[model samples]
Target chain A: MQTKRMTFSSRWLPYALLAPQVLITVVFFIWPASQALWQSMLRQDAFGLRTTFVWFRNFERLFDNPLYLASMKTTAIFAISTTLLAMSLSLLFAVMVNRMLRSREWYTTFLVWPYAVAPAIAGVLWWFMFNTSVGIVPYMLEGFGYDWNHRLDGNDAMILVVLAAAWKQISYNFLFFLAGLQSIPQSLLEAAAIDGAGRTKRFWTIVFPLLSPTTFFLMVVNVVYAMFDTFGVIHATTEGGPAQATNILVYNVFRDGFVNGNLGASAAQSVVLMGIVVVLTVVQFRFIERRVNY
Target chain B: MVENDRFGSLLAHLILILGVAAVVFPVYVAVIASTHAPGTFLQGVMPLLPGSHAIENYRTVIFEGRAQAGAPPIGLMLWNSFVMAMMIAVGKIAISLLSAFAIVYFRFRFRIFFFWVIFLTLMLPVEVRIVPTYAVVANLGLLNSYAGLSIPLIASATATFLFRQFFMTVPEEMLEAARVDGAGPMKFFKDILLPLSITNIAAMFVIMFIYGWNQYLWPLLVTNDERYYTVVMGIQRMVTGGDSEPLWHLVMATVVMAALPPILVILFMQRLFVKGLVETEK
Candidate 1:
């Protein structure tokens, strides 16, 4: 809420400046969102004619629907696993890269470029790598008496998507974790070393605790990411396939709306997603406020 | 890090090298795959080494495209992607900059209201509200156009907030000094503020460019016309567009093409990319 102490008096100029953003937001963001809210309360016939207004019927049916409930569960699993896998792997790499005196930048440059690869591209690459007939991972897994076919097995499909999602995200998490690790003053580690604490002990007692804020921030981001951003990861490879095994909420909204042409259900899903996003945004801002105060 | 522990340093390097290999291997495989002939993929496990057909595959995919897949040339799609990325990036930075300046410099009624309106955008990503947003765009007859691709994606909340935060940190004396020098607000902004904000702007440019380029679902939905296809979405077509299994060689070639620009941006402007990403998100 802070502004310049010596401020400009021109009222019209400010509105003019704000006009473009406000226009785009209202037309594209707000109008569509409100349309979703409004349409969620209505039902249309299968023929897309004679719509009838129904109060909360779409949402009520959505909760009662098994597939909708399943997607929420899938999103939870996918988001949590992707966050864990990405954060831990990146944290380990960050910690190790942080220790290197000479090859730190070299390793970092090598590690961070994956952030640039598009998620859809990342998914395709992994999908190719895990392609059952000729994939290297499957070829290797077959040696261990396990047949890896993402196209058929729901759990395998989930793992494939998770791995793809996590792989694309590792570079992002690495950069932040590296920044967090770098920001930790060396004097504290030196102090801990002098106190006869071993490396592992120092990391647990000193490094891990200091990195919590970064960890929490990345957790929220990665969850939001896995929820929404991994649409390409699903669409390009799985297409939410085999069953509804990998259909996260965003993809479901798309499928239900565009593919299924179930306007009512899709609109309801969009409204629900809007509510989720509002909650997440509020949570993130609250944490940000707390962090600023601290 | 504080102690000179040789064993620990050695162990750290070893772990880091392994991590780097793991990170690079997929792309390496992609690169290797792009070099082979079409028959190479169908023969079973893809060969790990480079093949002689590299130029032939790259040349075909970039210029001719896979005709059977009904996709346009990678050259055209790459150009489309570039144009869209530039528009989205520049448009976002321009609008966000103006709005942030307006909020920071002027004390106006409903300023807080306007800020919240902009802030609300952060909650609703395009993925969450695709149906209704698409309907709105369709209503405007903006579908299958560059404006359709970029405009809806350009109103960024984080960029606006970042500029606002940066503007706040700028010392108030600069404004007072500019006022004393008989300089107007716009004049002061162009002369002083823009120069100071170059780094932030460049950093934001890197982030937004990648974001715009990496977009998949939005472009996929809007631009159904082959002429408007972007390489990122076009690659998906090469995979699923044809009746037969995808021509892995050309598909990989297109993948490499689609990924190369943003990857190069990250490689060259890593500091800015890191700054923009961390600062914007955090």
Candidate 2:
């Protein structure tokens, strides 16, 4: 192989090429993020006008309000349960599809097709299945002498939201898991089999550990998805209905800003949400970095 | 052992078949609902089969004044969505590809710092920045315009990150070969790099298109005028009437109509979609 050292002049070319991207990122992303930080300090009147800066007053209000605390609890439950459930189901489906010899392509294609659909549309579709009056699931339950109404009950509403969120996430996690499975060397599994290891043992000792990096990546991505990206569904299906049963943090932030026009409080809530996410992400990376082989 | 393998195969097929049905069933409901008449749908009874009323319902949605009060025509909303999505798709991909190409193909000072900046942007949700972004867009006089809707979303950290990963795996020898052939940077990117990265580009395009199509909050805030509403916004208006009962069938029909183009795209490009994701793992 012929090797040539990259010269100093060549290095500057890359930076010049990257200038447009950096400029856009600064304009759209970094600048807005900093502005959000600044907005967290100010107070707004009922008319949606910023009045003055009252440092930590917004944060104080956030801690003082019972609804805000309940929303935090709701968000935690929603995020953790959905992420774990979605990841497990996707992993199982990916394994089954990977091991299948016949109709594998057909199964894989059909399974991943849902991920391509818009989240807003998925919310609409799922609402069709969960609606008390017209939904199939409720109708079926009634047929079986069981009553189910997501709109009337808080717990039922939470379960419905979690299920809807997790369903949309399964195909995303499955794609990553399938990709991870394909990248693993078959020789390692063969070696385990030759050593008289059972299928379950081989998976536990070899496949699971090797798949950790992918799993960790999926964990971070899934948490973020459950936390922030689920606004469309919450807006569509429940609209934080049955007395705010399905009101996750992002939905709360949105409702405050757009619905009630409390821009300052909403901005403060968003700042707190961002703070939690940043802390969780940092902790996740810190833990995963130690375990990640690559 | 052969018997055991056969039993396992049967089990796998059974599981996958059930999973596929669950995945496809809701979409089936949406399609069926779209075809049903308003009177039939209001009866709170769903048919297992498609109806002949799809054309009628669609005509009502499009031709009739089905828009929310203070909202634009449905056709205009769809047009807004299409134009905004296309612009965002093209802009995002161009920025991502160029940035990825730079990071992978060249060395520079503060490279790692730039990389981290990109990664950090992914963690900052739109909720965090909406207040500031709203002000920024207002200040720039981009309110109620296609440029206002599209420009703020022109850069995406996820696309850039994905493309960078893809670019890292491109063979260095190909670039060196092009250089030795006396190809300049522009020729090298145009002829050698872009051609080799076509699949990745297509994959990124589909992903970005979906992202732009589904955007709601930013557009909702920045573009107050009904003329700039996207399809998602239009659907939301139909579903949420204050005192009047929402037309469920019409809403589902609009939802289904909005979803059709993307579904068709996915169906035709299924292989590329899977291939794109698979390559990301490498």
lDDT of 2 by residue, B1-282 (tens): 212566677887898888888888888888888788767756775777888888877777765634433234467777888898899989988988887777776667787778777777766767666767777788889999998999888867778867777666677777777777888776777788789888888987877776787787677678767678787767776776555656766777778767776666667887776665555433
TM-score of 2: 0.90
Judging by TM-score against the true structure, name the best candidate.
1
Q: Compose the digit string of candidate 1's lDDT tens values, residues A92-197.
A: 9998988777788888899899898999999999988998766789988988999888878999999999999999999999989999898898899899899999
lDDT of 2 by residue, A207-277 (tens): 88989888988898788888888887788778887887888888898788777877678888878877877
Worst 10 residues of 1 chain A by lDDT: A97-106
* Shift in Å, residue B110, candidate 1: 0.4
Predicted model with the maximum lDDT:
1
- Where model 1 places Cα greater than 4 Å from the true spot, the runs are none
Prediction 1 TM-score vs. true: 0.98
